[model samples]
Target: MNFDKRAQLIRKYDVPGPRYTSYPTVPYWKNEPLSNEEWLQSIHRNQKHFSSDDVSLYVHLPYCESLCTFCGCHKRITKNHSVEQPYIDAVIKEWQLYKSAGLEKSRIKELHFGGGTPTFFQADELVRLVHSLLENQQVDPSEVEMGFEAHPNNTSKEHLEKLHTLGFRRLSLGVQDYNPRVQKAINRIQPFSQVKKVHELARGIGYNSISHDLVFGLPKQSLKDMLFTVEKTLELRPDRISLYSYAHVPWVKRTGQRGFDENDLPTGEVKRELYEQAKLRLLDVGYLEIGMDHFALKEDSLAQAFLSKNLHRNFMGYTTQNTPMLIGLGMSAISDSWFGFAQNKKSVEAYIDGINKDQLPVFRGHLLTKEDLVIRQHILDLMCHFETELGVHDSFDFNLNVLLRLKGMVEDRLIEIDGNTLRITEEGIPFVRNVCMIFDQSLQSSASREGVFSRTI
Candidate 1:
């Protein structure tokens, strides 16, 4: 992956594509209503394959006092602190509904609190929420992998200490960047000292596996800004670093990304360089690259999983644990039963309304077809391990037509086809999404792909 070759590939492959966080993505899902019976059947099917005790839980906290213009997550903007307790109560009720609907699995193997900002709620509010979630029983911190997303500016020492006491060992701080210009453009104005304080506090509180989120291709971001940010990140030496590509989809996010001028964003090669150089800096400092844009130390669980080719990517992005059922509990949250995908109401009011009716709150869903199941395995393997084998699927035909579609990638040295196996080259790491897209029959046939996704490179 030399500089010249990298630049050429970036220019050639810079096209709109889904992030492949989920197979059949969301747009390709059927638009019909998700019935209660259908969702239950999916859950029953999942239970047959997975252990009843092993479950992954994702709780989405969609409240943020201030808006970070670059964000694409579904969230409610408000300065009102009163929205906190009510929202927690609604989420707890939703969890109860899942239990009544046949979600008997109680032992959570992986639990993550993600949001507009998980720290937006008061410390006591989080306690009540988690207590109800775990059935008012104290959990052994070692029994579960608990993590949360925090805004460094708002993540107080009390927040860290309280969460640590409740079995939360992982902390992901939204550093985004240390560059003031980049911070101002994104409207997440936190100083380096503020982030430093939070990082030190989390470590002092005995939290493990700290991850810092840094974005490339941001508005007004330059090579110097990236270097400085990387330098500051190294100062803290967090366990994991997520070098995310800034998805500037103003058309989709509407007003969220409209605050900053689009012209200021780095595109194509410039955007790739920001990541490439920063990746080099991270690798030089002993950080090993994980799946996609994530990097971690060798001792980190994510890094260990990657080394063993067991890393997985779902709607939670990349994760160490790949449960048979991932139940997302919150507004706009998505649940996956391995063979089916269901989403809750997008609007906060609608979500709360549906929950009050003693329902699952799922509005739409898709049951995976035979072809979808085969393609999903291929995409998941490619995304997590950078390779896949044709022999895995007995019913699906991995024939000449599919090979013809991937000929361009093979010729460009982005991938190497060894008999019935296909592997992404080191240079092809950036084009993993493109390779996966070719196998996506729905995306390939969909005319809506132009605006529905961001650039792959």
Candidate 2:
């Protein structure tokens, strides 16, 4: 398709939509009928299906030295190092509370550090935090897949070496755009040289996988600018790449994205062309699309997971491992127990106060209904495999009304429906969020959709 036509299509379909990171999608989560006791029971019940070696842990480090204009993630902006110790101590206390809830310590199989910039903490502090968790748990480091996000400008040799010693094999660095103007607009001033140095340092420390995050459709971004970023990214030769569309939702992110004007950003057509251009360039350089917005080399774990049909998606995006129980620590983190989802308090002081009072620090959550579970499974399949088998419905009480709603999408050539299976066609990749929307009963019934989601395109 030509850029004009593609842009028109995006304009037509780029309505408000959820990212499908979670089935209930946070906004639709039922805040009532949930308590910390119910949350713990859900985890305990789900843990019975797998041994301790199958659990995954997600730790949220919410501090960042500065704000990035296009970011919508939960974060605390401050350059002071004084906040690190108290936050780390609170995280340890939170983990101890989980341990006290009867969760077995030996069951951890994965540990991922997500952040406002996990590297915002000093290297030794990070080591101390990880060691504290290990000290209280009976975890086997050999079986654990440990990783963290690193800011290329601040990630040092000591950081890499110390994290490597702690068994972190993977690292993801944010390189939103190599263009200096775009970097300046986002308030993240990182040079290509700094990124290269971090990449080389990570490799020198024997890190197995390195991923770079790039963005398209940012304010003041052009085709030439995107190509420049892609060319520079190719030079780094990272194992994985996440090419994300810059979601301009100033209503929610408020101060973060307010730096740039809407007129300065590309329109739908230009944005689509930018994505298509980057996609072609990446494929030419041997990166396979693992799922929406993510690409990996053929030999990388992500690609291997895709080939094996073992790919999974969670709040952390895509992963190779599927764990029914995930414990999210720190402020504003959400933990998914398959049966239910729980989110912690968003304020650091509130989190600390709750933990000090010996509480779970969870402020809200939802328990999945029977329909929710079925829809969630299908969404997971579509997101991971680009197709899903509806045959699994024979054992569940799913309403066929949802399938009837997808007929229009099938006619639009966005998807193919065949003998109880629905597959997203190549033309439908960009509209994956729309296809998932067909099954979102809550969203369909809601009166206010505009305030709840960002654009799907």
Segments of candidate 2 deviating more than 4 angstroms = 2-5, 49-53, 136-142, 394-399
Colliding pairs, model 2 = 7-269, 52-107
TM-score for all models, in order of appearance: 0.97, 0.95
Clashes of 2: 2
Error of 1 at 222 (Å): 0.4
The C-alpha local distance difference test score for the whole of candidate 1 amounts to: 0.88
Off by over 4 Å in 1: 136-138, 394-398
lDDT of 1 by residue, 1-457 (tens): 6789878888889999989888899988984699978987888888877656577889999989888999999999998999898889999999898887776555778889998788999999998988888884458877788999989988888899988988999989888888888899999999999999999989988998899999999999999999999999999999999999999788879979988887999999999998889998999999998878999999999999999998998888888887778899999999899989999999889999998989888999899987898899999999999999876673445545578799999999999999878999988888899999888889868776678788986
- 10 residues in a row with least lDDT, candidate 1: 392-401
Task: Give the Cα lDDT of each candidate.
Answer: 0.88, 0.86
Candidate 2 scores a C-alpha RMSD against the true structure in Å of 1.9
